[model samples]
Target: MRKRSIAAGLLTGVGSFVLATAAQAQASAPDTQSDGGAAANSQSEALTAEAGGDIVVTAQKRAERLQDVPVSITAFTGETLARAQIQSATEIARQAPNFRVSVLGNEDQPKFSIRGVSTSDFNLNTASPTGVFYDEVYVASQALGGSSLFDVERIEVLRGPQGTLFGKNTTGGAVSIITRAPSMAADVGGYLNLQAGNNDYFHADGALDVPLVQDRLGVRVAFTASTSKGWIDNVTGRDLSTISSNALRFSAKYQDDADFTATLRIGRSRSNPTNIGPIVNGFGPGGVSSTGVNPRINPLTGQPLGQRQGAYNVIGEIRAYGDNANLTLTKGLGDLTLTSITSVIKGQFLNTVDVDGTNLDALQINFADHSKEYSQDLRLSSDFSGPFDFTAGLYYFKDIADIDTDYFIAGHSFTLAQSYRQTRTSYAAYADATLEFAEGSTLYGGLRYTSDHGRLKRFEVVPTIALQPTLKYNDAKPSGRIGLRQKFTNDIMAYAQFSRGYRSSGFNGGALNSAADITVARPEFLNSYEAGIKSQLFDRKLTLNLSAFHYDYRDQQFINVVTVTSVGLVNAGRSKIDGLEAEVILRPAAGLSINAGLGLLDARYTQLVLNGVDLSGNRMIEAPKSTVNFGLDYTAPIGNGDIAFHVDGTAIGKVFFSAQNNQDQAGALFDLNARLSYKASAGWSVGLWAKNLTNNSVVTGAVSVDAISQFTTMPFPRRYGLEVGFAF
Candidate 1:
C-alpha cells in the first residue's frame, strides 16, 4: 500500500507541472532577514512565498546550500514552518523523511529517532540516541524536550551518527533549532499573533525587537502561551485539559565595526499539561479473545478496558520546566574566524499516568527527574587562499542528574524513592578539512578524539528494601568520517561516505542488587556506509535526492524491564540496518508546490540473547518497514492580498513497540494537516489550520510491564483553529 501511494504521489507531482497555476504570484516572505542566518533565494513567487528559496544551512558548522552539503539532511525555514503550522518537533517529523519524533506522556519529553536508530526505553536515566540542539547549545535531558518553534530562524535535521564536531555522542542523528538573532535593522519591528479554536483553545505568541544602538547593539524578547480545556471525558473532573504550554525568551547582540560580534541569550519554558489523556485497550495478548486463564480485567475494579470517557478514576498530570542560557562570541582575522560558545541548562519534570488503561484504580505510576548540564566550546574555521578549507574545535562538558519513581498496583504501592547524582567531564578536539585538488571534485576527511570521564552513585528504597549503587569510570574513543564528492554539473552532485559513530556506557541508577548491577552497560559502536545523488532538474523547478545506506552495530544498548521495581540495559550483541530513501520537491508552476518522500527499511537483530533465549531476527521496536510523506501548497493573488492553501499527510508502516513483537503490539498511523491563509500588504494576516483532519485513531506507542499486562498511549485528538497576526 505504501509503495502504491508513493507512486501515485510522484505521478501527481509530474502531471501538475502543466496544469496548476492560473497566474503569477507575489512573494510573502519576511522583508529583512537576521544575522548568522541562512538566506533563501527563491526562483519564483509562490516558490519563494510558500516554499521559500534556496535555503542556507550550517549543518557542518559552515554556511552552505542544503543541496551542497555532503551529508543527508533536511531544512525547514521559519516561513515554511509558519505556513505549515508546525509548532513542535513531532509536526516537523511528519514532513521529514524517515524521521519519527514522539513524546512519552506528552509535551515535555521527546523521543527523536532518525531512520531506525533510537533508544526505546522512556526513562529519565537513559539518554535518547538522537541529539537535540538549540542554537548550537546541546540539550542533554528529556526534561528539556519540546522546543517551541517561534521568534526566528530555521530548523536543520542531520541524519546519521554525528560522532565528530558536535558536543554530544549520538548514534542516530541531530536536530538543530536555530533561533533568530537579535535584529539591528528592526528598531520596533516584531510580530504579534493570536489564535482561537474549538475545545476551548486559545493561544498568544509574539516577539519584540529593540535597537539599543543604530548599528552596534540590539535586544529581542519573545513569548508564547497556549491553553485549552480538556477534550476527552474524565470521571475525576468534568474533563481533562492536556494542551497547556508557555515559554519566554530574551536575546541581545553587540557588533563592532572591527569585525567582532557577541550575542547573549536566555530562555525558560514551563508546562502544566494533562496526561494519561486518553486510551483504549480491550484485546488480550496476541489480540485474541481473553480466556479466563488470561483475563482482561482490571482486578481492583473489575472494569473492562476501552472505557468510553477515557478510563481514568484519578486525575493524571505532568509538570515540566526548563531554563537555559548561552553566550556566543566571534572574531574575524583575515581569512580565519575564531568562535567561542558557553552554555548551561537546568531542567526537571514529573509525570503521572494511569497505567492499566481502564476506569479502575488497578495500577498507576509517577516518574520524576531533574538534571543540569554545562559546556564550553572553542573553534576556528578557515577558507584559505588556496584550495584547502578546514574547521577545528575544542569542547568540554559537565552533566549531573537525579531521579525518583513510584508505582501503585493491586491495592499496594511500591515507592522506589531514589536519589541519583552523576557528573560527566568530557574534553574533545576535532577537525574536518576538504581539499579541492581538481576543478569539480574534492577529497574530504575528519577526525575526532574524545576523552570521557564520569562518576555515579544511587540509593533506592522500595517498600522496606534498600539498594545502593556506586561506580566511577573514564574512557577515550576516536571517531572520524571519510567521504568523496564529485560535482557532475552545477545542478547535480554525487557523493559516498563512510563514517564511524560512538555512544558512551553509563551505570543503571536503580538496581535489583547493588553489587551485581553497579557496573555500567557496555558502550555502543556503529559504522555506516552511504551513497547518494542530488539533482536540480526541470530548469531548477524540481529537486530530487536519493540515498542508500547500511549500518553495522555492536554492543547496542537494549533496555528491558527486569521487574516492577528495577530496569536494566543489555548488550544486543550485533545488528544490521539497511535502507533506501527518496525525497522529491516539485514546483509545478509559479503558485503551486508539491513534495513527497518515501523510505524503506529492513532493520533486524542478527544476534541477540535474553534469558538464555536467542531473540535474533526480531524487528526493532519503533522502526517501521515503510514510511511516506506527501504535501502540496498553492498560492494565488486575490485582490490586494495573496491567499495560500496547503495540505500534507504522513503514513507510517506497521511497527512493534516491544522486543517481544506481540501481534497485539503491532500498529501503524496516518495523520493529515491543512492550512489556508490570506496576507495583505498592511503587515497583517489571518489563517485557518486543521491537524489530524480524519482524527486518525492510532496506537502511537506501547510498553510491556510483564507477560500479562501492558501500557499504551495514542496520538492527540484532532485540533483546528483560526489565527490572526500583525507585523510591527
Candidate 2:
C-alpha cells in the first residue's frame, strides 16, 4: 500500500510538471515559421544519426527517425546484435528496458512480459497482450514464435499501447522484426558464417543477394542450421535441452522506376529439441510423497547430486515446424502513397514432457497443436511537405488452431485424453493525423475501431465427460491516442499522451471436469497516461530519453486455480501499473560507446476477489520492480584488421510467477554476455562469444497442481562459442 501511494504521488507530480512545461512552450511558440520547419526536421534527423548511428524504426507503421517518433521505443540494428552475440529473440529482453521473457518447457515457446503486462495462462490458444510481428504481420501463437533471426535488418520494441495502429492484442505493446529485403541496386553478393561451441554445438548460416535485371528486379536467399548436444544429463538415457533447428528464407523484389515497388518473402523452419522437464518443488495440500526429495542428492553438499542432471523416466521434447509467406506492395500517387501487406502462416507443434522431475512418472503430458493464420493490411498516407499529414488503414486478421492433449499421473494408473479446435477473427479501421500548427510544435491523434470474435468448437475427451459442446465470445471497442509533441530545440523534444488499449476475450483451454468448468474471460482494457522527453546534447554525442506512465487496468485476464487439480481463465476486477523508464547512450571517445537503461515499475491489484476471498493488493506476476542494463562497445585498429569488444549485463529484481505472490515461486537473476571480434580489410572476420557467463539457472516459470505441488522450469546454462565468417 505504501509503495502504491508513493508511485501515485510521483505520477501526479510528473504529470503536472510536464503539462505546465508544454503549456509554456505553446505560449512561447505561438507563431509559425514556415521555412524553419524543414530545416528543423533535417537538423533533428542529423542529430539522431550522429547520436544513434541513424537508427530508423516503424513504431507508428511508418518509417521515421527513432528520435522523431513520439512513442518510447528501443531499436537494435543487425550490426549491434551481431556485435553483442544476441541470436534468438528472447535474448533481446536483457538489453530492453522493462522487458522480460519466460520459457514454457522449451526454447521454442516464450512468453513476453513488458511493462508489467503479460499473459499468465499457458494455454496454447491464448494470445499475449504484447503482440509479436514479422514484417508487420502479427503472430498469434507461441507455437510459431521461434522465428530465426538470421539475416535481419532491425528489431524495434515499441512501449505503451499501439492499438491505434497495431489494433487488438496490443494492450501492453508490440515487437516489430523487419528483415532484410532484396535490393536491385546491390550487386551479386553474399556472406557465410560457421560457429562451434561447447556442449557439442555447431551452427552455419549464409545469405546471397542477386540482381536479376540490373535496377529493376532482384532476389535474395538466406539459410541457417544449428545443432547442439544436451547440456542436462538425464539418467534415463536421452539428454535434455538438446537443440536441432534449421530455417530458410527467399525474398524477391520488383521496382518500376520510383513509382511502384513490390516485395515477396517466404520462409520455413523446423525444430526438434529435447526439452528440459520440470523439477518438483515441495508438497501440495494433503499430497503425500512416497519419494522424498526426488533426484538423489549429494549428502556431503546437501544439493542436487549433479552439476546439471535430472532423473527422468520419460524423455521430454518438442517437435515444431512452420511455414510463412508475406507480400508488400507500395505505389506512389504524387503526394500520397498507398501500400498493402498480405501474409499467411501455417505451423505444427508436438510436445511430450515428464512433469514430475522424478523417475516414477508421477505426472506426464503429451500435447500437440496445429495452427493456420492470415492477415491483410492496406493503408494510405500523405507527404504534403506542409504542416499537415495523415495515415489511414484497414486491417483484417484470422487464426485457427487444433489442439490434442494427454495427461498421465500416478505411474500411468490414471490417464486422460482431450482434443479441441479454436478460432479467432478481428477487423479494424484506423486513422492517424499530425499537424504542425506552429513552428516546432505538433498536434497528433489517432482513432481505431476494432471488432474481435472468438470461438471454441468442442471439447472431446476419452472417458466422456459432459461439458459445453461449443463456446463463443465477442466484443467491439474503440481504442486510440491523442498527444502533443513540442520540440523545445533542434536537439530536445517533449511529449504527453493519453491512450486506451484492449485485449480480446478468451476461452479456457486447460483440463476440464464439468460443464461449469468451461468458461470464457471478458476482454481486458487499459487506459494510459504518459509523459516523456527525448534529448541529444554535448554536440550530438550524448543521448538521453525518459518516460513516466500510469495505467488504469480493468478486467485483466488471468489464470485462476479452480481446484487442486484444474485451472481456468478468469478476470481480475481491477489493477494498476505505474512505471518510469530511462535510456542513455554516449560516445565519449572515438573508439568507444556506452549504453545504459533503467526501468522501475509499481504494479498491483487494486480490487480482486477469487472464490469469496479478498485477494487485493497482491503484486502482479512476472512484473519486476526494478531492472537495469548497461554495456560498453569498443573498437580499435590492430595490424591489418580492427578489434571490437562488447560486454553487457542486466540485473532483474525479484519476479513472481504465481498470482498468489508465493515466495516459493519468486526469484531474481542477472545475465552477462560478451563478445570479441576482429574484422580484416579482406572481408573476413572471427569472433568469440559467451552468454550467461555466471551460469545462473533461475526458475523462469511455474505450473501449480491443486496448490499441492509445483513444477518449475529453468533457463539454459552458460554457453561459449567461436565463429568464422567471410563476405564475397
Point to the candidate with the largest lDDT: 2
Name model 2 segments beyond 4 Å from true.
Answer: 1-52, 284-303, 562-564
lDDT (0-100) at residue 698 of candidate 2?
81
Per-residue accuracy of model 2 over 1-728 as CA lDDT, tens digit each: 56656655654565455444544444443232222122111110112232333465667766676767789899888777778877777788888899988876676788888899987888788889999988888999887775667887778888888889888888889988878887666579989999999999999988999999987889999998889998777766677878788999999988787778788899999988876755555463333333444344432344564646767778767888999999888888887778888999999988888776767767778878999999999988777888988889999999999999888878888877777899999999999988989987899999999999888887766664544467898899999999999877555678899999999999888755665666889999999998887765555566777788889999989887654347778998899998988888988888899999999999998999877878799888889999899999999999898999999998899888767777445577888999999999898999999989989878778766544456677777899999999988
Q: Which candidate tops TM-score?
A: 2
- TM-scores, all models, native as reference: 0.89, 0.92
Worst 10 residues of 1 by lDDT: 39-48
List residue ranges in candidate 1 displaced over 4 A.
1-52, 236-238, 278-308, 412-414, 463-469, 509-519, 663-666
Give the Cα lDDT of each candidate.
0.72, 0.79
- Positional deviation of 255 in candidate 2, in angstroms? 0.9
Which lDDT tens digits does candidate 1 get at residues 397-459? 888887777767654443444556777788999998888779768788898888888777655
Model 2 Cα RMSD, 1 decimal: 4.4
